[model samples]
Target: MDNHFVPKLTRRALLISTPFVLAGCTTASRETVVTKPIVPAEYLAMYDAVDGEPYPVDAADLTRVDPAFLRREVAYNTPEPTGTIVVDTQARYLYLVGENGMALRYGIGVGKAGLEFSGEALVQYKRQWPRWTPTQDMIAREPERYGPLASGMEPGPLNPLGPRALYLFKNGVDTLYRIHGTTEDWTIGKAVSSGCIRLLNQDIIDLYRRVPPKTRVIVLQGPASGYGV
Candidate 1:
């Protein structure tokens, strides 16, 4: 098992948990559920299918996903003020800092694109059912895959950006990185994506509703609690 800085979780957080096996960044692995996880009823309901949207969202099959990646409220120790967003790329977790040392944590999937941008940034804006356009670098790297769609892809269930997207910016300029939703729920804890951070469609929707424009977001490059840029 790789070494990771486990956060000082609250008793409430610990009581509602199990042995969460962290997956590797290079390859995908099935979580070894030694003891049945005592998942809260509310957590399960949060991922349930939605009734009205631009498209239908299927309920997340928690059985196939690692419990560590599931959304939970944890005791996060960060200097960043409440309402700040922190992304621990190495741990594949994103935290929305809340008052009283608490945070709303979500599992994330990173890739080369996701790792490209790090450090402090702000949520310039957000979009629901946002259109997606492949970057020039992406077109150059995988022409056949992204070339034809250079113009842009309309928002829908098939769109890679999923249903909601939070655009990140630095110095008031677009960083081309985004915190968005993904159709590949199985990839929640993996490092396989064409672009930036991805959360489950259900999870993204929840995050979108919580944060507004200009929200501060800190993307930590290494271990979960590594303060370094």
Candidate 2:
């Protein structure tokens, strides 16, 4: 046993070993993209093959889909760090930012005119097959529609929140809005929800699995074609 013959890491050795790290910084300082992440064709194809629904999705229901509502990946240059969820309320598009100026885009249904919610929030919690309950305001607006469900509706394939729900919070309080799933895929790319942000059930389920609690979400107004830098 040679107790005193320990390996040494010299400054020159460290510098030589990490030249690529410093080169990356230099490349970034130049403000030109040297490399970018690309979503593979096979990876993109998986979204179309989502199956094993709790109950079969109506074949007729799936056939009427508008092409614009399909999930996609796009070049999204933003100052926001990777993993931030940016919602363009006016555009009816939600972007999940990722590395090297790329994003996963989802078509969504937003709050109807007066019910729009805007600003920054954090994903406080999430659920699978979440329960549904109309807010008091909803009950007041349409007692006949929501009065019976105020206590909370049980989780099911038909729940308005659908297969997944990402509860948002601002300043440690519930925002009363969710980035949630809905079975009504046709509603996507339309502004027709009561007040919540809605996505296709399959899409939300995919998103829920990707984003964790504490992720920052920015809800923005205006028709910004892509995220801002």
- Ten residues in a row with the worst lDDT in model 2? 14-23
- Give candidate 1 regions above 4 Å deviation: 1-41, 113-115, 224-229
lDDT of 2 by residue, 71-107 (tens): 6666777767878899988878888887677677787
Task: Identify the candidate with maximal TM-score.
Answer: 1
Whole-model Cα lDDT of every candidate shown, in order:
0.79, 0.73
Model 2 CA lDDT for position 27: 54
Q: List the residue pairs that clash in candidate 2.
A: none
How well is each residue in 1-229 modelled by candidate 1, as lDDT tens digits? 1112223335454234444434333325675545444445665676888879968888877766788888877777888877788998878899987667777789998876434578899888889999999999899988999999999999998999989999999999998899999878889988887659999999899888778788889988776443322
